[model samples]
Target: MKKIVSVAVSAALALSLAACSSKEKASSDKESSKDPVTISFASWTLGTEKEQNLERLMIKAFEEKNPDIKVKIDESISTSDWNGTLSAAASGGKMPDVFALPQIPLALSNNWLMDITKMTEKDKDFAKISKAVRDSATYNGKVYAVPYAQHFLGYFVNKDLFNDANLDYPEYGPSLQEFTDAVKKVTNINKGIAGLNNPFSISDWYPAAANKDMGWYTYKDGQYSLDSKEFIKGVNLAKEFATNGYTYETLTDEQKANFKGENPEEVWLQGGVAVKWDGTWAAPQDASFDWDFIGIPGGRTVVTNDFVGISKSSKHPEEAYKFAKWMSFGKEGFMKRMKIADEKGKMMNTLPVSTDKDVLDEFFSIQDVPGIRTAYDNLDNAIVEPVKIIPGYVDARFEGQTGVKAGDNENATVGQLMDSFVKGDLKVEDYAKQLDQMADQKTKEAMDSLNK
Candidate 1:
């Protein structure tokens, strides 16, 4: 009886051991099925609601197609505060898997980005991307970033208004005053037409032949001068533009209401305004007006979207590469993204930076939109706006440093400081002096950071 009980216990133990081995083998096989990866991405911003939505949808689609990978988004750093945010992340040694490179060269030199040249070469979509875009992402003989889009900002004008006023359309070359005078002459609000659309205010939109030389930024070398006599002329030109009923603040309550909605640029599309200064992307495709655009007066600045780079800190570098490639190289994936914007009835304003024959074919397949060809032409002298392009410069801007109460009214702020002189509350010389002081302060701050 004792032997029989011991044998029975041993048999049960063997059965339990067999069950454990099978469970372990099944777990190992599941783990080996596919390597799972989760990557974190950061950018200054995804921009408008449509843009934010587009990213979410794109990520969802990517994950659906590639189930082994997942993406986490971190957009807490506004472009205005991107430099500081990135610095803090670096200090914590917890940088994102992918991020923006506002200072591309600085990031590359610091080993913050990884070289993805081999992966890019292997990707089918990379083969179709535009050389200009691919070149921007290349650093030190290696591809460190992914070029997404090219954008252009300038003036979109109503051809009918120019014709009605017997004024020649603003094209290649025109003095700032020439443009302002034309806007004034065309203004006849009683006739239900505004000579210009200054919905956002009247600062950089005023084209100054002088700005062609100033180039918007005060780089470290300091060869350019905001206090230069030429620059003052440009600032005064902006003031004159406001004085001539060219600003949106001068519009009636009824006219103002037309632009209160989210997409106010549509007011121009309705044929109520003759001139609007905005990014070329604001121009809608289905507008029923006769419109054309000219590059911003200086034509020196070119607008491009922030580039995507892989973080050196990324543990899943290959997976991060796959993420970047999926977004850029996979045409169908991107086309799916564009479809979201299309459904939202928004102008993408960004042209594809890929020369891939199929992608270009897909891009142009959409009915040709106006101002796009012109925006491309403007890219000939592509450059950057110091205040808009560079991250820290805004904190140093006149109005940005000093709040609205400094010299602004409730109606507008973009040109309100300049408007103060136009309204005779201030002197042009004082305005110029104020600008000089601001520029000097900014330069000093920039210099200190560089020395550090």
Candidate 2:
């Protein structure tokens, strides 16, 4: 009878311990549920005071809406060393939850990005983003990043210089010939005023301007036509501009000696250059004279975009996605950003990727630069700068993937071939075919590597 009593007491003790353990787990889970998740965000743009403040304001607004999530700004990453910094972070398993993408191909190759296709598909606002912008972040039919901001590649005209020359300001979309003629008319070698700056980017702009369907370097159908007639024409035009007095690069030694300013290189800012090939973000904030922006010769232009992505190593992906959307294409976030800019009486340097009417309306109201609206309107026809998307583009263009040397210089790369042509050391017709072949082969190799 005593033995039976002992067994009953032991069973009772086991039951009590099990119940206590279950209750403890339930209490711990409740506490964990209430704990806010914090995600880290890093951006090179945060190096600037104005941009940092703007981002902080946006973050504050985001936090107000998302009380369960917190964003911590990671300032250790910087513009000059962003790539190296990110590489180190990725290797150490300490990659920020969200960060700006300095190179999309690098990010994709390293598997740094998370597959956010599902999140984007479920997001109604994402559909409102421009197709080209969306396509820029997509690789192999998968979305890995989002275009956070963009700047249009075009001409920034000095109105004062145009009026002084008695020449009408070039309209928004001038033909190549019209643009060339205007450049000639505006140039006054005797006065040290150049019609255009050294148009090094003629090769980039000419083909696109000449052919509406072609992108930079005549990229189409996943191949480059660097040796095409259109490309040769662009190269010849660049050579012609340099040979003539229209561009600063071809100016005579005498002309340089007789330049009108203490710093002849400062001609653009001194209002001595009629039109400068540059990006919209380079627009002068407080100029001594009036200025306006216009698209490059053709109706089509190039756009440089900065992208953002959620890190694959992020522990809180859902929260990270919410923050990334708010800072990128989300309409509500854009509205709040515009509100902040308006209140501060400052203009945003980056253009919105969203096509939402309300977002655009707010953005345009705050960005009242001359001809800016028309420039924005032309985005429908613009091509994104290729190096950001095309695999091995940087290698083919800059890193000597072609193994072709310039002239007899065994160490020279395919990129230097253009400079040689412009300088009259190499003939465009002599090497166009070779360059086309090299570009195609290198690009194919890159694509194949990616597939593998």
Candidate 3:
């Protein structure tokens, strides 16, 4: 009986211990489940303390909405070295969960971007984004990045200068002829004020301006149309303005020396130039005189976008996608960002990519810059800037892509050829065909290498 009792007691004690272990495991798991998953985010735009603080607020707002996730901001990356840093991180299998993309083609080619096509397709809010922005993020029929902000390149007109020249302020959508005429009328070499600061930007603006169907840098249908008549027109137009005394570039050395400002480079700020070819972000806030922004000479404008993408190496891809969306085109996030900006009495530098009515209303309410709203209202007709989107553009443009003879050399890059053409050493009609072929071939080579 004693042995029996001892055995029974031992068995009961063992069962009790097992039950306690089970209970402890259940409790531990419950506690662990409450721990939030952490993800990392990086951006070159957040270099300044104020910008980082704003990003922190954005992160805070995001955390409030997503208590189950935590974000870690990586501030070590900067614009100059982001590509190299990302390349190293990717090779090490330690890329940040989400980060800004400087070049979509580079990210895509290196497999740094997580495929977000399904997420984007199912996202109702994403569907509300502008087509131009959506197209910019898509590559090879797949979405890789989300547009964070868009900066429109347009004319910043000094209204006072226009008045001084006795010319009416050009409207939102001025024709090329009208633009040319305004430049002529506003020019007064005697007063040391040129009509347009420089016509160099016309090279960037004219392709789309001349033909709304063409993309910036003469990109269209996955090919470059550098030889298109529209491109030739734009190049010739730039030459016309540059050679004439209408532009600051063509001003005589004596004229520059006699300019009103101590710094002739500051002519635009001194209200000496009538129409300054610049981006929407360049709109001055504390100008001594009135100014307004308008679209490029043609109906279309060049819109450059900043993008954010999730890393392919991310462990928490879904979570990273959520954060990326929040940082980019998510309507709710934009509303929160606007609220934060308003509370801080700060102005947003770039426009929201969201096309949702509520988001636009919120953005316009806080954006008080003159003529900016009008310019943004016409974003439907805007063209995407090519350098950010086109693969190998930097190489094909700056570095020599073809061995074709150009400008007293056996090989020349498109930039070199353009330099020769603009300086009147080469004719566009003679070299447009070769430029088109070279640009297309270089782009194809880049794409082929990426595929391999």
Best by lDDT: 2
Off by over 4 Å in 2: 1-33, 48-52, 76-78, 249-253, 260-265, 345-347, 401-409
Q: Once model 2 is optimally superposed onto the true structure by TM-score, how far is the C-alpha of residue 364 displaced, in angstroms?
A: 2.0
Name the better of 1 and 3 by TM-score: 3
All predictions: root-mean-square deviation over Cα? 9.8, 6.9, 5.9
lDDT per residue as tens, model 1, 107-210: 65456777788888888778676454465566446787776555556677778877877888676334565676667777776665676665332344332345
- Tens digit of per-residue lDDT, candidate 2, span 170-223: 877788888888888888878878888786788877888898778888887688
Ranked by lDDT, top first: 2, 3, 1
Residue pairs with backbone atoms closer than 3 Å in model 1 (clashes): 128-356, 130-354, 130-355, 281-349, 302-383
Q: Which candidate has the top score in TM-score?
A: 3
Q: At residue 30, give the lDDT of candidate 3.
A: 97
Cα lDDT over the full model 1: 0.61
lDDT of each: 0.61, 0.80, 0.79
User: Any residue pairs clashing in model 3, and if so which?
Assistant: none
Q: By descending TM-score, how would the candidates be arranged? A: 3, 2, 1
* Model 2 lDDT-worst window of ten: 256-265
Error of 2 at 428 (Å): 1.5
In lDDT terms, how accurate is model 3?
0.79
Give candidate 3 misplaced runs (Cα > 4 Å).
Answer: 1-33, 48-52, 75-78, 262-265, 401-412
